[model samples]
Every structure is written in C-alpha cells, then in structure tokens.
Target chain A: MVFGADRECEFLSAPRPSTQETFSGQPLACLEVLGRTMVERTVQQFFQADVEFVTLLAPVALSHSLPSFRERNRALKVKLANDMPLAIGRTLNEYSRNGIDNCFVVSGNLYAETDLLDFFFFHREAMRPVSRAVDHDGPLDMWVVDTAKAMRFDGDQFSKDVNSYLIGGYVRRLDHPADLRGLINDALVGRCAMRPSGREAKPGIWIDSGAGIDRRARIVSPAYIGRGSRVHEDALITRSSSIERNCRIDCGTVIEDSSILANTSVGIWLDLRHAIACGDKLFSLAHGVAVEISDPSLLQPMANVVHAAPARGNLEVIEIEEENLFPLSTQEEAPARPKWQLGANLIQG
Target chain B: MRESSPVIVMEVPTILNDVEGQAFLQETQPLLEGGRPCLVLDCSHLQRVDSAGIEVLLHCMEDAMKRDGDVKLAAVSPACAALLELMRVDRVFEIFQTAQEAVQSFHTPAAIDAPVTLPWYSHPGGLDALKAAS
Candidate 1:
C-alpha cells in the first residue's frame, strides 16, 4: 500500500506553494518522475518485487481532486486507499483477520532505485515487526510489515521503527521543490531507473513518441519533452528542461531549466527560466516567487485535449478566442448555431 | 441521401494547397455557372487546407450565390475544421458529417433520421436566411 500526505513542506519557510499550486491541482504522488508518476513507478516496483495487488492509502481530498490518479489506478487489481488515517488500521485489521501476514507499505512521494525483491526476501527472513528501506541517513518510509504484529500496535508503529536493517541504496523523497528538480536531473543523467517517453534522438536527450517539435525549434539536450506535447516554431528548449504531456510552447518562447507541467500553454514570445509553470501559475526558483499569468496569449489551459492521445503529425492549430469554444455567459456565446435549430429555420424558410 | 436529380456531390482533394485549390475552383466554376444552384463539396478525403484553399472555397460559394446556387461542405476532418475556424470562416458555410447527409439535406432541410440531432443553419448564402430571400 502507498501512503500519501498532502502536508505542507516543512522546508519552505514562508509563501509555501500549496499542493495544488505545486502539482497543477494533483497530489504529490501524481508528480511526474521522469515521465511516469510517483505512484505508477512505485506500483511497478511492487510488481518487480513479485508482490501482487496493492492498497493505496491517500487523503480523501487527494482521491477526489486528482482524476489522473483514478485513471492511473484503474487498470490494476489494487484496492483504493480511500482515507489517509483510517485506512492504515483498517488495512492491517483486514489483513490480520484474513490471515494475510506479510504486506509492504510504501510512501507515495518517493522513488527508490533499489532491488525490492531482495529487500522483501530479507524482511521475510528477519521476521521483524516491520523492516523498512533505510540508508545511513535513516528510514526512507518504505517497509515490509507483518500484519499480525502491526495489528498489535497503533498506526504510529510504521513511523516509529528505524532499527530495521539498512538496505543501503538510493531513494528520492520529492518533498522539497529542489528535490523535485533533483529527480528530473537524475532521470536525465541516467542515475535514476526511469525512462523518458521518446526514442533517444541524441545522447542525453529524450523526446516522447506522441510529442512534436518543429524543425525550427531548438532543443539543446540533456533534456526531455513528454508525450503529446508540442514545441512550436523558433521555440528554444535548453539546459535540462522538461516539458510534460500535451503542453504547447508557442512560437519564439525560450524555456531554460524549467518544468512545464502537463496541459499548460506557454504563450508566444515569453521567456521561462529556472521555474515551474503549473497551470497559469509560474513559480520562479531564482526569485522564490509565484505569479499567476492572466493573459491568454502569454499562458492558457489545454482543458479539452489535455488527456488526449499523442500529438498528431502536421496537424493545423486553430487560433480562435478560447471563449468562443467555451462560453460562460449568455452574451459571449459562440456564433455557430446548433445544427437542429439551423435545420428547423431552413425548413421554415 | 435524397434522390434529387439536379443535386451533384463533388469530392474535394485531400490536400488543398494553392495549386489544388485553384484547380478545384476551375473544375467547379462550370457547374456553378450552369444554373446548378445546390452543390455539396464532399470533404471526407480533405486532410489539409491552407489560406489559398479557403480562398477558392469562398470563391465557389460566391459564384454559386450569384447563380442562386449554394456550396455546402461535408465530412470535414478536424484539421480542415481547425483551418476554417482559425480563419473565422466556419460560420460562412454549411457543414455536415457525411456527404450522404449533406446531399439528403438538399431535399429536406431537417435531417429526420440523423443520429446527431444538433440544430444547424443550412444556408447563409453569405447572409442571414430569414433576412434575405431563399
């Protein structure tokens, strides 16, 4: 089971970017590690360890707020971790009652590049109350817990034990904003176990299969462009930058050392550097400021095609006022009349 | 589709660049000028259309109108739809999902058995239908 805390980062002293601000309305688990979410990669780890099925425990708010999480978990036989606090005791009790003893509990916000099968086997031999993933720094909040022993104590036991044998290896806890940058950089450098979306066009650069970059677009690699994303003409993608799925970089935009989240639109002629652009809000790492861009030409939301398939080759882009597509009020409605009404009027005529 | 004797369905080329667009205009000019007032441009195969292509389509629409004829588009691909919308010329012409439907529309303005029951304006002929003569 994966545990997710929507807790504010203890690191950011003031003006802490909320979880929604940090992840474009997604929970921490939904943050892309390379191209995959932390939850998906964690589940992949469980399967690699030969552990079948999972119970993901997340805050109920997170469960409802993130539709993508629901989509990611839709395929697997894993049980939904509906409530964050109540689920731990309930899961342990259910396991104990069902005579299911050994189960792994992993934190959802981290990706550890360790051999999970080896760790699980070690935990099985040691037969401790719980054996967690640990390095010299301390416990990484990933562990194998025996349900019978877990049932004997409160939910706090999962957090209490650090004496569990150290499986000295690498782990990325994506709590701080800088740590997130580290994860992307690590993924780019081949230090992490994850893979980027596209074929390796050149060394240290990865582009997704469904994404597109115009011939005039300049990409100095050691970077990644996620699936379904588009880099328009004369756009510059350089210096370890990552642009996530379905995002559109308009013409003449320069992106340097930034992470543009999925479904965002970078308007034409803007310069985004050392920042994280999520939705309309851009958080600058250089100045430690987050500002919301209200200009549609500067930045917009790809609400319709955000979750769609890869970018189609040679598809023409329609440049219409977005309000024409979705009008909130009666007066500003689209000029295109409904077909039925048109037919009725035509027949009457 | 209707069994209308005078209505002719014409298929537009897939790629309507400048050359193809000009050719399309030349090919359709005779039919439009021959007192054939109702024409359907079947766009099921039309994958791409540029500014020149839209210009030619508009020209045919203009000629058809002078002869009391109308040019309707059918089965427009998303790429072509976007092109038309980008040019803000989508409202100028009648559009349908299938050539059969567009042809049948010439007979009865109301599509009785069509699956998509969206309300539409069949003819502007470059002006509002109610404000102008049919």
Candidate 2:
C-alpha cells in the first residue's frame, strides 16, 4: 500500500486553474529538476514502481481545490481530514482493519529516480518492522511500515519518525534552492551512483525519454533536459543548464546556467542568466532579489518581457531558408588572433 | 582611429557556425572608429560562444575604455547572458535591451560629443600619401 500525502478527494474537488497560482503570496508548488512539478513527478515515480492500492491523504478543505487530487485511479483510495497526523493514523487503522500488512508513505514534493517498491521489498525481507528511505543527504524521503508494528495509540509524527527510511535520489530532503542545484550537479557528474539499469551512458548530457530536441536546435554537452521538454528550432542550451519537464523554450531563446521550472514558457529573444524560477517566483543571483510573476501568460510563472517576435511569420508557408548565425569565415578567424600566435606557431612550425 | 578604442561584444551563438571572435571584431571595428564614442553590440543572433570568444570581448572592452570610449552590450542571448552573469562581468558593462538603446545612450545629455580624433592604423594608401608629402 502506498499513501501519497497530498492527494485527498477534497483537495481535488475544488475549482482551480491548471496553471500554477500563488496562495497567500507563497509558492505552493515545488518545481523539480528537469522542469517537472514536484508532486506530479513524485506520483509518476510511484506508478513506475508498480505499487497498486495507493491512497492519498489530504486536508478535506484543500482536497476540493487541488485538481491533481480529483483525478484518481479506481484502485487508489483517498481519505480527507483537517489534521494530517490524525488523517494518516486513521487511514493506517482502517487499512490494518482490512488486513493490509505493509504500507508505504511518501511526501508529494520529492524527486527520486529510484524504484520505490523494490526498496520497500528489500526492507521487508530484512524483517525490519519500520524502514526509512534515507538518501545520501542523510534525511528520509519515504517510510515503509509493517502494519504489525504500527502502534494504535502512537501519534502521526512519532509514527513517521519511527517507520520512515532515508531513500531515493542523491539527497533525501531538499530544503533550499542550492540543495536542488547540488543534487542535479551531483547526478550529472556521476557522484550519486543512481543510474537506471541498462548500459550506463556517461552523464555529460543525459536526455531523458520522451524529450524532443529539434534538429536545428543546438544542445551543447554537459546539459540535462528532463522528460517532456521541447526545444524549438534555433534555440541554444549550453553550459550546465537544467531545463525541467514540460517547459516550452521558444525559438531563438538561449538558456545557460539557469533553472527554468516545470510548466514555465520562456519567450523568444529573452536572456535568462543565473536565475532560479520556482513557479511564480524569480530569483536573480546577481541582484539577490526575488520577484513574483503574477500573470502566467505575461511572464507570471516568473519574469516579464516585452519584445517583438524574433522571426517573421510567413503565413503563406514559403520555402524556408534558415541562415546560420555564424558563417564559416567568421568561425575560422576566432583562434587566429595574434595573442595566441606563439602557441599556434609552435604547433604549426 | 586609435587602436586603444576597441569595442567588445560577447557573442554566444545558439546555432553552430564558423564565426570567430576575430571576424566579429573586424566587422564591428570600422563602426567603432567612425566617431562612435560608445560601441553597441547586438548578440541576439549568437548561440554558442567559447572561452576564446569571451576573452576577445574582454580584450575589446579593455581596449575601448583605455581610449576614453565605452563598449556597451545589447540584446545578449540567454546563454551568453548567463555566461557573463556567471563570470560576474555582466555588471562591468552597461547592458541594454536593444542595440538601438545602447547607441542612443551615446547621444544622451551627459555626453560631450567632443571631437577627439585619433590616428588610424598606417594603411598602404595613407603611408604612400605621407611619403609623397614628405
């Protein structure tokens, strides 16, 4: 049994926009590395593990507002209540009554590339009543509990602490933006040691499955694009840039050393450098400032820009003749500068 | 024109092409010498820029400022923008939204528009003219 903490029926029933919205001036959703919504990606990982009979526990009032909560599999159960501690306890009690022996609980905002069910099974085989998924970062991302060890009188926090193991990805709990960056960089450099089975491809550039890169688009090495990111024609991505899932980078835009969160659409000809965009909040590394993008269509989601289209739209659909930004004559002249004359002469002479 | 008045613009290309830093500087140097106190560079067309390209821009900026001129950047591509920001050089120069803006800044009220002309590189024609006069 897998229990997702933020997916109750009540949260799903409420009317909310599909795009991200700021709740009380706070960023409500977490954006994962490679442009995926943290919650959506976490749920998908659970499905990938093939664990049936999942249950979502959410606040009854919040359940009515969250759209992801409304869509559920018939096999998955959902329970709603005010207090998270009580709600989880009651669900475990109910599941125990139904003779379910083991349960898996995970936070909705975690990004893990590991197989969760296998991890849980390993814990069970060890005869551990409570197993926590503790990752390299030394905090727990998930908790697996044998129903037999669950105490009836024990509170929610205590149950979580006793049963949860630190598991999944390079780090267990991502507390800050820098932690997320560290996780991605470590995963790319092969320091994390968590590659999905198969002939391991070196991580200079790891393009996930289902990602589409246009032939005309240029992707330099050492970049990681998450699943479902579409790189349009003539766009450039280079130098330690991580584009999260479901992001639309328009044509003629360049992304370098920037983290564009999931579901954000960067306009054409815009320059985003050293910036962290989480939903509607944009943080500039140089300025040490954060701005809230209130309008999704007009750069809400983060950052606003007003500019003409980079390319002319030919509605008649004439034959397209793409021009190279840098011609061959120009490219050959870069290293020919006299400053490196000695080095070039030594090699040639 | 004065050799010190070099205008540097860092270009990060989005498409893979053969344009080199020397060619880029060569194309822009003529405009910089034509009484343009501030050199404006548009990097919107660029995609990928190597470390050599960055060094070229820095050299140009240093040269231009040495002769009492300024190199301004405009419409920097996102990749190049990030690189400059990462190197902390984006703060070193005035970055404008468009080349027109950077150019127009030269005509601002604070500018004196002093006609301080410098000697140009000794071309064959100029050297021949000087020899004939002597």
Candidate 3:
C-alpha cells in the first residue's frame, strides 16, 4: 500500500506576490528547478518510484521549518493542515482509515517523467478508480485514487472549470510570473499529461526516456535531455536547449538556448546561451538578470560531486604562459601569407 | 548638427523605464553632448529593456564618445537586438541601416561618391547568357 503526494504541499495557496515578491525581492520558500527544491524535485520523483508509504500534506508552518523536509521523509507520514483542499482532505481521510485502497495523487510542482511511470502503472491497472494520465490538452497530471472513489470526492468536488479531471498541483494555481511561464511551458509540453514522456522532442528539443547520448555528444536537434539526462564526452547541446533531470553534460559544456533545469551540474568550458539555470539563480534570459552562482566550482549543485577536473591543469597553464612569452620556435613567425590577393583593389584606388 | 537635418527621431517604447531612461537621456543628451555626429536609435516602439534601459544606451555611448559623437543604432527590435547581444553590450554600439543612413553619416562628406561602375557583368554562363538572349 504505497501512497504519495505530499512533499510538504502548500503548493502556492495564492496570496500572490511571492516568488520572492514577484521574482527576487528575496524570501523564496522554494520553487527552484535545476538545483532541487521544486519540493526537492517532487521528492526525487517519489524516491525514483519506489514509492512506499509516503504521506506529506504540509503546512504546520512548513512541517516545523524544513530540516531537509525532516530528514528525507524519515519513513514518511506527515499531515499538517490549513487548506490544500483541507490538507488533501485530511490526507485522504487518513488513507481512508488505514484500509488504503489505491492512491498516488502526485504534484509537488509536478515533474515526474519516469518513463511516464509505466504509463501511470498502466492507467492504474486498467481504470481502477477511473484512472488518468491524459494530456495533449486533456489535463490530469497523475491521479490514481480509489479511496472508494475518494469517498465520493466532496472537497468541493474539485473544479477549476474541470474539462476532463484529475486536478492536483493546484492546477494552474501557480499564481503569477505568467503562471510560472505557464507552468514551465506546460510541463515541457505534454500539457498536464501525467507523463507523456515530458513532451518536447523537437523545436527546442527535450528528450527523456532513458537518456544517454554520446556518439560524441553534439545533440543539436533543438535540445532538451531531461529524464535521467546524460551527455558526456564532446558535449555541445546547442541552441534553445534545456537538459534537465539528473543532468551531467560535462566534457566541454556549450548548452546554448539554455534552461538546464533539473539537478544541473554542467562544467567544462561552459557557454550556456540565453540562460535560466534556476536554483542558485543565474537567470539572464537575455539579461533580465539574476546571477547568484555561489560557486560549486562555478555553477554547481547536482548534489555536488562531479569530478572531471583536468584540462591538464588548464593545459599546463597555457603551456607555461607560452613558454614564458612567445617561445614558439624562437618566435619570428609572420611569414607564410598569401590568403587572397589577386586583383584585390576594389575601391580605394 | 546639420547632416542635412531631418533624422533625429526617437519613439523608443517596447517598455523601458526610469522615466524612459531619463527621457532617453534628456532627449539624446543635448544632441549627444553637442558634437551631434550621427544619432538615430528609433526602435519602432521597443518592447522591453531594463538595467535602467541598458544604462541609457551606455549613457548615450559615453556622451557620444566625449563629444566627437557616434551613436548609430537604428530600427533594432529583435527584442532590442536580443537584449543587446545578451549584454555583451552589442559590441559597444554602432549599427546603422537607416534613419537615413544614420543621418547620412553626419552630413555625407567622407570623399563624396566614386565607386559605381557596373554597366553589366552577370554571366558566369548564366545559361549561356540566357541562350544568347533567346
């Protein structure tokens, strides 16, 4: 009996004016994408789907001031209250008074694409509590309740104008800042689908299924490599790029169109175009400015440890400052010319 | 200030403030601090810029290079030249393509006209000169 969805959920109960008072007035209680804390990447995608006994309905003043959300959900089970549909209806009425009949209502800023969690456990074992995973505009990002049809769902029968159901993650209650860029471009373009493989596979690419890549990492097809992302040796991931989840694009970072959102750690001669890095800030979406790179060897935070250090000590300090200043074969080299000069006088005659 | 006078436009809007960056640096800081050498910056109703509107165009290019004046950026809006080449400061400004050729490069006189000899020469076997002109 594994139940989830409670990474200390307050999931923005709209008072507005707070994403640090509309972007960086400074007091962020969490919502950082590529450096953890979108409620710790939705509790590390529910502990990489091994989801056993999780509860977390948060807000007893953020479960007593988040000590790494109380030491990684120590054998989970939290139920603080104060409205989140009455704390997820009193934690689904205490998991339906312990008789726990199917439940997995996810969304702590939803980001689970674990191969769409086996198509949400095969549409919750073929429509159990009338399952869901719908997207391509049919909303519903994960839902598998059968607490006897959620005790006939009367928490105001959830309706933010429901057109095709399953609404958690405060459905569009992401308040402002253009609803957090339309909830991160509608969860990277699968439009609320529980996990239709985190959409985007072209026009600004976003591949995520088992994520590998390194037939010599060039990856330039628009670019975004989420779910289990990796791209070692010769990395380049060009224009309008994204590279989220379990990231690591070392060996020559050039990630252009830039977003690098989930669990980032890109090093090696980094170029990062357009930019948004997220967690430890670094935003510059063409200079809207944010920069707080607190050095983890310059832009760290993939929970640290990413060792690839050695451009042979920066090419031996540029070949010992070019052999103490231009000692290239006793430097006299300005001779081999002839690039293009036949009939060259075009105007200054 | 007479580049055959007619190009000192200035609408500037795609949202930039600080009273529109101090009213576009007080109406182009006195014709770019008097040398008035070539100043367009129209930006067909801009759309956004802040860092005090790119520090008033880097303070009108440092008050037009301390008065020898030279701030020619015209009609730029691809989101204001991608926020000035992502703040690499668009290679320190000077990008003209109109505003009457940036006020005719301040009164056109750097060696007036001399290069236009083209009576005709497009024949790298242009279909054998269009089959000997059909």
Highest-lDDT candidate: 1
Q: Which ten residues in a row have the lowest lDDT in candidate 1 chain A?
A: A6-15
Interface-residue RMSD per candidate?
15.4, 10.7, 9.7
Regions of model 2 farther than 4 Å from truth? A1-50, A59-74, A78-80, A111-129, A135-141, A148-169, A184-216, A222-234, A244-252, A278-280, A285-289, A293-349, B1-89, B92-134
Identify the superior model by TM-score, candidate 1 or candidate 3: 1
DockQ of each: 0.01, 0.04, 0.01
Better of 2 and 3 by DockQ: 2
Say which candidate scores most in DockQ.
2
What DockQ score does model 3 reach against the true complex? 0.01
Tell me the tens digit of each residue's lDDT in model 2 across A17-52. 222322323223333454333443455455656555
**lDDT of candidate 3 over A3-52, digit per residue (tens):** 24421111222122244323332112244332233444455456666555
Which residue pairs in model 3 clash with each other? Answer: A34-A261, A240-A257, B14-B46, B14-B47, B14-B48
Best by TM-score: 1
TM-score of each candidate structure, all chains considered together: 0.57, 0.49, 0.29
lDDT of 1 by residue, A105-176 (tens): 776666677776566567767867778777777667677777778666565756676337575566777675
lDDT of 1 at A191: 79
Residue-wise C-alpha lDDT for candidate 1, range B1-134, written one tens digit per residue: 43344778999998787889988888888888767478999998987666678889999899988876678899986546644643446789989999888888777744453423432354434346434652
